[model samples]
Target: MSIRSYLLFSIYRFEYWMQKINKKGAAYMLALQDVTKKYGNQVALDEVNINIKEGEIVGLVGPNGSGKTTLMKILNGLIVNYEGEVVRNESIGALIESPKYFEHKSGLYNLKYFNDLFGTKQDVGKLLEQLNMDHYKKKSVKKYSMGMKQRLGIALALTAQPEYLILDEPTNGMDPSGVREVLRYLRRIAERNNIGMLISSHILSDIESLCDKVYLIHNGKIKKEHRPLVGFAVEDKDIGKIEHILLDMQDASITDNGIVKVPKSESKKVSQLFDEHGIEIKQIEEKSVSLEEMYFDMVEEDYK
Candidate 1:
């Protein structure tokens, strides 16, 4: 190859590697380490460390008084008295607690007001369209139903098109249809804009479908976390039969598929053993774990 062509190739390779490295570094949108928050004698958060990566939609799940709100407040930069380190890589949009709305102003006005806060000039018309709330834009927020108010709040928070978005107790009072509409847009935000969203909600189904992963917090700490599971059912009645089929396998991750996963090297041995047991493999497939099951696992693991 000519020196000119060689140099061009080298430059292209260098640029590609640099971009990959930059993207990897940009993955983490937020990180909290050894964080502690206190209110006189009451500790709201205790030595917490959590990291939120870019392009990740994470749902915070916890019962009331479990410190879910406190963690979200710290994330929104609303609580500055924390004892540990909190880092956010970019600008954020947040609506925490009950979103403060202009009772007298129309929904469009609220959007415009928040847009001005971030010094953005995006058209309210377009935002309303995206949120599927164009019909209610001109109506007074005070007249809006609880669901409508939450939708407007979501629209307002997203007006800035922030890199980091945090919503605490989102969908507090939305009707089923309203909640579905909101989740649809939130999913679009994650998929299309690649925004990292930290949402705390009591709606388990919404969290299951909307989030890339879930974070369970308890007693001011992150008790557990997991990605969703996809799978068929496995009953305890079948466990005994399956165990007899493969008692040789040590600490295998067992599920309904009859000793589902073993170490890669031992997979063949386990499979052959199960096959010999005359186990009618009805369906041996990868399965997604249900959100309810995941929640149970989170609680169980935390307590154990």
Candidate 2:
């Protein structure tokens, strides 16, 4: 083989090895343990713990100002003055906040810029195509809309082909269709490349549809690890009574539509409570829990 070809081959082998092992030669993973961050007197993240292994899609779900960005920034090595441990065993690529580029440069130009900088030898044109941004490749970023720029940001993040990806609100500014497309593409690439992803988004539906595990954060703290709840619809009049009865259940809440949601394991308790309360029987149908419902329950429980 030519000298250049041999060098390229060796690099690929090294990257693959890195992707598969940590310093201990164990399965690769990115982790945050007892991670805490504070800005002056205000805490940004409080004792956060999370882990992601190759080919796994883990999500950080929280509302605005809930430390999702703070966590992602720390993982991406953008913020350094935090207290805690961040364990990373593979190369990382990140798309955080906004995508910045030379205003006068075309999307293709900006992508190529990063590709060369990382020495990843990515085909810029193909990357654009994968992101559905090929049609806009020749347009200067200065003229690009928010959605287009978002796509370009993701494309740039993939330039290095890093084994771990930290994406913050990757679908921000996209239309509904664009959001679906990006989520699908991200899932495909993550699985195909066995890339571990740590994604932060306030969009619970998006997180629910894409992630294998989810960490719900609120008030700069992780409130709960995700567990599916079964929702039970009841009369509006009984909503208050049902909620009161389930008060002891940290994961139970009466949603806005008069549906009482509780952990699947607590279905018996819920049924017994209604029976003892002399509440009329409506068949309880088991259904998948909405992230929003679970978030509401956890946040309310936290306040109590």
Candidate 3:
């Protein structure tokens, strides 16, 4: 191979090795340990710990007044007077809330302005194209819809090609279609660029579909950490009998949909139990637990 090709190949191999080491070593791009924030006498965040590994997409979810916003602010350095250590990658991008732009300027012009301010050499046209906003690149921001604005906000955050992104309620005020569009763009950006993202949203469905892990906060505390569930699903008419059999097994529960969730490791035992008890199995399949159900379950338990 030519010298140029050999150099490129060498670089690729080096990058692959670095990524492998990062994964095995738990090299987090951002981490917040025992973070706490207060407002007057009220605690907004208490002993919250979170970590985002390189190229991972993490979700922050909680009810209103549940300190989700406060935690996000701390991550972005918007609130620095809080307790705890926040370690983050030096190169970071964020869209905490609504992005500010010249109302009368074109979208492309606004992006160019920020690019200049940040001394970044990012290609304006390519950024707009990636966000599906190339057609309206020259249109005045005043005429852009809310969804369009949100897309532009994301483009602005990406101007510096940062390694990590922090977004708060990116789909707020958007219609269903708009929400889906934004989510699709975000997922594509994260995977294609191999960037870590911490996204906070009230939309549980979006979180369920996109996030690799989720942090549920309640009453100023990191109440629970949930991963995308993986298990076996068994449906039987004798649901009550099956429940009794699996009662002593850990990680076994019957969902409200009347499906018994058994750990994949215990699938054979579950099958044998059903056969020995003569319980009729209507269907069996592999399934994942919905984030909405998990969120509600966590919140309910906290209340109790």
Candidate 4:
């Protein structure tokens, strides 16, 4: 092989090895041991213990009153209170908030300062370039738009190249295009660098897109752990179609709140018919439960 070809091959191999090393150490990047957060009489997080692996994309989810923000704060050392141990390694990158930057300073200037503080000689320009923000490097923070600011946030978070990244609503205030860009870039980083990410978003669709595993927190406690809830969301028109099909087929019945429950003998048959008819199924399982269904069921049971 030519010398240049050999060099490029070696570089790729080195990058792969680095990712492998990061992945190997990702078993327990962050561990929350019996943690609880209290705000006066309210329980923000009730004795929640969670272990996040090093190189996994774990999305934290919950309803409006859920403890996603609290859990993230505890993980990022932003909230020092609560009971239980928040154990994390030294190298941790947190975008828990849209961190303030020097309004008058160029983006590059900001990275230089951050790199100095972190005592790491990372290539700041290349990092910005990788995030497609190199063109915006010389501009002051004040000149950047909100979406640009989010892009800058991502660039800053990756500057440390920490194995663990904590993102709190990473795509908040972003347009659809911006959200897509951020998710794509994050996935690239996670795959390339084996960066373990803890992403929290109130938008279930965003969480579904970015994470393979999700943690659902409700009532200050973890309601679901490491479960990817997959189902279809058929429109009202499609719902009627599904109902009609179920009624005519006799193997399945529509349960309360529009859930189509199927007997084990005909789950596959029901799924095939609906899929063939272009019925947008919110979800279908042989005998699997869903987050939405599970929540409503629990609520009804509690009321009783």
What TM-score would every model get versus the actual structure? 0.71, 0.72, 0.72, 0.67
- Screening candidate 1 with a backbone cut-off below 3 angstroms (N, C-alpha, C), the clashing residue pairs are 229-288, 229-289, 230-287, 230-288, 230-289, 231-287, 231-288
lDDT score of model 1? 0.71
Q: Which segments of candidate 4 are over 4 A away from where they belong?
A: 1-27, 229-304
lDDT, model 4: 0.71
lDDT of candidate 3 over 146-200, digit per residue (tens): 8788888888889978889988887777788778877888878777788889999
**Candidate 1 regions off by >4 Å?**
1-27, 229-289, 294-304
Candidates' RMSD to native:
13.3, 10.7, 11.1, 12.4
Per-residue lDDT of 1-304 in model 2, one digit per residue for the tens? 6534654664565554344333554443798778899999999999998888898788888778889898887776666677777778778888888756777989999988778867889998998998898789998999998888888988888899899998888898899999999999999988789898988887888887787668999989988877555667654465556767777887687767677877654676777888787776565765676778888897788679
> Local distance difference test, per candidate?
0.71, 0.80, 0.78, 0.71
Find the candidate with the highest lDDT and give its number: 2
Please give the lDDT score at residue 53 for candidate 2: 81
Residue 206 displacement in candidate 2 (angstroms) = 1.3
Candidate 2, lDDT over the whole model:
0.80
